[model samples]
Target: MDFSRTHFELFGLPTAYALDRDKLDAAYRELQNAVHPDRFAAQPESEQRVAMQWATQVNEAYQTLKHPVNRGVYLLRLQGIDTLDASNTKMSPAFLMQQMEWRESIEDARAGKSVTALDALSDELRAAHRRIEAQLAELIDAARDFAAASEAVRQLRFMDKLIAEVGDVYEELES
Candidate 1:
């Protein structure tokens, strides 16, 4: 259990976008069992504190590796790239136009209180999200193109927020 290891290394997995969820889950459980604070309760105070730290690190690593978007961003970070930095806000014009269209559809659906329209939009957005995920897998795993993967991750971030908004709309409609 090396505290300095990256999330992938911590999980004993390859540092690639495509990962096996079952293996990750197994590794997480194994690490958690080893570093759980309760395992050190009978030890000295210093040992307990160290166990707590390891527990925290393992939990954080698990979370980062569990999500596809986070995994992609973390992979880029390992290569000295920061995808969330403010200075990296360059998106393609075609994508910007698509965003505008999606926003307009969302606004229209909300204004009309059209559940059907919202449902259709949600399906479309979900399909888009799936397509982006496939692209990310290719860029990060097959191509090993971090530069393009960063852009895909940014696009994914947008889709995530939009999906959340769609969920909000669904809740509003239900109420």
Candidate 2:
């Protein structure tokens, strides 16, 4: 109920990249049940307003902590780092080449209308995504290297976008 508390603190969780998802889910449900607006409908208007605010805060906290990418960015922000900075877009040249190759593969698959090829590409990208996520976990949790972790976050974001694009191609092929 303390508005100024960090999302992890609100959920009584450790402020680390590695988290117990089950714990988060349980805590979120408990908090939501406690402050859901409907539960305050019979209360005074002032109390209801407060409950609404609390509920909003709880939901935002839950959402931020639920996603691995968002949680990583939030952790960095807590340390006074902004991962979304335009200046932080510096990725390795090798990764740039890889991104181009991925785009080409996606385009080729789309052109061929090959569901099998697209599925293979999706699997490759997902494996890469998991590797990057593992790196993020180590960078943020063990090494405490926010700088490296931020870069991993950027790479993960790109992978997330690319994966979504592949999904779009699947839909287009289906249609």
Q: What is the C-alpha lDDT of each candidate?
A: 0.91, 0.93
Q: Could you give me the TM-score of model 1 versus the true structure?
A: 0.95
Q: Please estimate how well model 2 matches the true structure, expressed as its whole-model Cα lDDT.
A: 0.93
lDDT of 1: 0.91
Q: Clashes in model 1: which pairs?
A: none
Candidate 2 matches the true fold with a TM-score of 0.97
Candidate 1 lDDT, tens digit per residue, 61-105? Answer: 999988878988999999898999999998989998998899898
Tell me how many clashing residue pairs each candidate has.
0, 0
Give per-residue CA lDDT, model 2, range 107-164, as digits (tens): 9999999999999999999999989988898999899998889888889889989999
- Weakest ten-residue segment in model 2 by summed lDDT: 87-96
Give the total clashing residue pairs for model 2. Answer: 0
